[model samples]
Target: MKKLLISLTAAGILAGCSASDSGNGQEGPPETEVKTEEDPVTTDYLQERFYEGMDYDAYAVEIQTWVDKGQASISDTVKIEGQEDVSADIIQVADGFLAVANDSKEITFIKPFASPEDAKEYLKKNL
Candidate 1:
């Protein structure tokens, strides 16, 4: 009985010493935390690439505003190059006009317009 008690005591001591020694009296490597920023939802995301010397950021802001205020709704149909009439809403942004479908599924950029009027005329003829 005494030997068994001593063996248990030694086992307990060894276990406690090993656990304490594993700490090494020092801190571990600092934990790494990752953070991420979500991109704003807007039709401007469809812009493939920015044209040189174009103020695309301002244009993106305008597009975002139009979307937020529900100003992007237009009841008109525009003819696709070869497909049937597609009902699309139009918005004029810097350097061009964007035709966004009712479902917000498609966006077409018509460029070379000095103003919204010019884009309207182009739409009239094209559709």
Candidate 2:
């Protein structure tokens, strides 16, 4: 019984000595942390490059639109050449006779000049 009591006391002392007491130290509430701002990504981002590139016919139409809004001096016809003859809708003031179609999908907007004279051009241009 005496050995058992001494053994228990020694074990308790050993356990107490092994346990750390620093967790209760006076460490004035955790320091107020200031979160740093995250920097923006430099790459790996898709963008509107095609939209940024204003095609010539699109530009002409935009100019005509601006002209039509207030002034009538701009003589740009804003013609749009599509797969079918949609002159009425395309040549008018609103859609600038413009549209995003399957042809633009296969090729960029610079496939060919939007001019009806594309067939008669002297530079061997494709109609």
Candidate 3:
């Protein structure tokens, strides 16, 4: 009789401990983190289009003008290859903008002499 009682008590303790160890007493599958991979072509396009050197203020004004005209829109973030995702002031012209102004707020415009169609082709290939 004593052994039966002791076994029952041990089982109860084990059950309680196991339940507490599991999260919040909630019965459901464990939570998982979802990671989305950035497209390499898009990353390359952003890096190639917007770089360290270029006229930011001029581009900003031009882009803002386009935005006012409803020809463009300013967006929030872009994922660049070889760099962490950055919050940038992105001007979308036509299919996409030729530059971006990053966190430093310095905008980098399109490669000096590249045509808009060239930029568009570069982005359109894998997009």
Q: How many residue pairs collide in each prediction?
A: 0, 1, 0
Q: Over the stretch 1-127, how does candidate 3's per-residue lDDT look in tens digits? A: 9999999999999998988889575543222222123322233444443456444554455445545655556543344444453324544444344435343345533331134454434433422
| TM-scores for the candidates | 0.29, 0.17, 0.31
Pick the TM-score winner. 3
Q: What clash pairs does model 3 have?
A: none
lDDT of 1 by residue, 23-102 (tens): 57854322222212243322353243322232433334544554465444332345455445443445543334555432
Candidate 2 lDDT over 23-87, as tens digits, reads: 45533322222222242211111112123333435434543543454321221222234444211
RMSD of each: 16.9, 23.2, 17.2
Query: Which residue runs does candidate 3 get wrong by more than 4 Å?
Result: 1-51, 77-86, 97-99, 103-105, 108-127
Question: How far is 35's C-alpha from truth in model 1 (Å)?
Answer: 20
lDDT of each: 0.46, 0.31, 0.46
Model 2 Cα shift for residue 93 (angstroms):
17
